[model samples]
Target chain A: MKKNLSEDFSMEDSLEQIIQEKNLVYRPTRLMTGATLSYCPGCGHGTIHRLIMEVVEEMGIQAETIGVSPVGCAVLAYDFMDVDFTEAAHGRAPAVATGIKRLWPDKYVFTYQGDGDLAAIGTAETIHACNRGEQICIFFVNNGIYGMTGGQMAPTTLEGMVSSTTPYGRNVEQMGPPLKITELVAQLAGTYYVSRQSIHKAATVRKAKKAIRKAFEVQKEKKGMAFVEFVSNCNSGWKMTPNEANQWMEDHMFPFYPLGDIKVDGKLVKNVIQDL
Target chain B: MAKVRGAIVVDIERCKGCEVCVVNCPTDVIAMSKDVNSKGYHYAYMEHPDDCTGCTNCAIVCPDGAITVYRIKN
Candidate 1:
């Protein structure tokens, strides 16, 4: 049953208030409905989390889907998202997701991990999971440093950035070099799709939304392992405002970790999800 | 006589306490409360509704669509 409103008791002339109540460009969103997040004011995690949630909500998969979260600040991610989510051991999300997804093949399983988790400790799980060609979605958030436990140098840390662990800046002689996650993941034969996108600007956000949706679609079709590593920012951990952090990423990070698709199965065809 | 009927009302449950309302409001009538609601979203209220001046900037910026302010003549 639909509710309709009749003419109100009060009638106004041409001076009535005008409202642009329809065709909204975007809404705040309902996916992030719990605790006042502890994320710093300018962190990109919030925005990426919100985008993923919105996609899940729109896809109506939250009810049947379960997410494997990492031990980083994103460990509490399950609280922010409405989907049925499980907290994985630090850097073990890919393995956890692989196990759960195999058991409950009908359910949508995705792993949300950070740079430290994905590129460092869980590197084997991630590489092998994608190598084995498991059917699942992996949303890798690369913020360039350890965010939750403290700002420490991460595997994805750039060449000359100072972190709590590397104050003098990462020296290749000692630290080797920053790992390019997307490029590394692309080398895996099992991964069917891979793209690196960010949620910083509107255009990038739109593309990221689409790419995320595509990854889910690939999983739905059982194509193979799908991965999306968003070059997100950690304004708080990096000690910068939202705008400042975005600028830093564009100026410094983007050059080191350029954004785009590293691999894809060009032959497989399916209906493209509008927003993804 | 012109009646003061136009005012935006916020749905406290849906407000995420993001303060987009407080920050985006042109007239600056919206404010987030330190108290928590049942759903746990921070409740936003009309502190200086008088200063609204019929502007819907608060409603427009709300990501949750948790506000409804309108003018009604009786």
Candidate 2:
């Protein structure tokens, strides 16, 4: 804390200087509960959670917003976020979110889902929700493998990525290609906006937050389904340290999943969006 | 150009001591505290407080949302 000092300076002057020098510019949003997050150190889930709550708080939609928590690592999202939430079975968040959104068309509704929950078991629910043009936002956290279920191979796992189930690295010929679920959803005519983002770097976090805020705005506009997929890291699942996982993700994940808007305003995003 | 000063407050109890903030800080302003929090992890502190530019990079990278940032222009 900085203070003003002079022969004539009063305590009030010092207090005023302190207040001016230390005004808060950024902090955790009140939308998050005080409970400590259970995610492992450096897990992207925490960052994504903060970004979502920050967006919701900025939009002043906490009271009317309804979120659907999937059965994966984010299953306990309701406990952390200070908003209305409905629990969904594994991969069924889209279905649940669709129901809530259809009933209360004015309320902002979204789904917090993981790759395992959405791509593997809930693929149908996810595709159908977007296909039906449900007015909702879908926040998909794709950390490649199923972090909660002991590092099992998920539908979004990279072709050569190693998981508990794929001890020798995934065989592309046998396992098929990694699922580009976000691209698939973008291809549907119902989606209004679709983007793939990450939170590993500070600049990327800002972009991801903007993407989420745009998706929320789309929901408020009564636009079709807005899907924002966050390609994240799972340190424990990958058996790597937090820093190492982030480095590994940058080197490996970005090559395949990449990042940028796949669709915007119900039209295909320009091809120039792809990274070299 | 105006001089830049930055302030940061880390919720020690809420911090998991992951050090993501420490690593991401551009000015080397943050460091692991010698003292541990309730969770037995060494929380982060502003080791070089005067060096902070208030860029908010540490807060942006903090996974636990434990840090808040403030900036002053002089």
Candidate 3:
């Protein structure tokens, strides 16, 4: 067969070729609402949302999955994701997810939260739910700042990270150190799987998706709480271009919120074990 | 070695012109189109199709989920 009989095979032509040849490589997952996403350019929330939805679609749980959308940048996640979603007050997603999981034990229940909602306002709910082993999945998007609330410093904001409130960069002396919520939750015996992943690069995106899938699988097994943290970038809040923010995240965010599983099967992962 | 060919279809209107896909493409197969979409932002286009190795790096990094990649191995 002739590879390309046409000199100029435009994108449409290529798409048509793919349809005719049945060689589809990568297409948008069905779980996405297909509506234009509201996230700012280069925001990691969209990437994280797509990854989770991709996992949901692949696992064939679109109808059975219930997501708790917390107050923060991704509060409107339900508009983008096709799954059933319940809106929770600021930092209360885990508590809401706990209720849903308890009522519908067979359904896949997950909470999508941001650092401001998860690490700061929702810390108590997050810790308790995980500690109690709610049999739910928590997808935390830690962009280090309150992205939707005009770039306020979040609990996960790093030292020297500047925000509207911390105009001079976060001072460890005054503001205290950034909270390692993933590690804190991983310490609990009720947690079964805990991992921190990022979507800064293609390789990392693949890894993040895999982690999300694993977390969902753990939830399916009726295991304890499964938490996956996505150390993300807020380009608009950080006052940097999408590209620059990504570079900044790699330089600064990854060092503090290093990626990998902290715990698996109620024990510290090999990397964390070695660190100890 | 047989030449590896790839193609990417971008939803022009859905693209916010973040350039995440453009910068992340390993093979330089994509570029922002000179034409603007209805939203007045320049969308991405396959400026050079033959160079694409179908690595799917662009699709992976696109936050808007605007690009779809296809590959043909000869």
Q: What are the TM values for chain B, all candidates?
A: 0.78, 0.90, 0.88
Q: Candidate 3 residues A55-117, lDDT tens each?
A: 999999999999999888788999999999999998889999989998999999999999988
Candidate 1 lDDT at A44 equals 61
Off by over 4 Å in 2: A1-22, A270-276, B1-4
Candidate with best TM-score: 3
Candidate 3 regions exceeding 4 Å error are A1-21, A270-276, B1-4
Arranged by TM-score, best first: 3, 2, 1
TM-score to true structure, per model: 0.74, 0.92, 0.93
* Residue A275 displacement (Å), model 3: 7.4
Relative to the real complex, the DockQ score for model 2 comes to: 0.52
Number of the candidate with higher TM-score, 1 or 2 = 2
Give every collision pair in model 1.
Answer: A10-B73, A28-B63, A210-A276, B8-B69
Q: Report iRMS (Å) of candidate 2.
A: 3.8
- Give the alpha carbon lDDT tens digit for every residue of A1-276 in model 2: 554335345534433443343467887888999678888888888999999999999989889999999998888999998899989988889998988988899999999999999999999999999999999999999999989989999888888899999999989899988888888888788999999999988999999999999999998899799999998999999999888889899999998887998889899865523421
Candidate achieving the largest lDDT: 3
- lDDT score at residue A198, model 2, on the 0-100 scale: 94
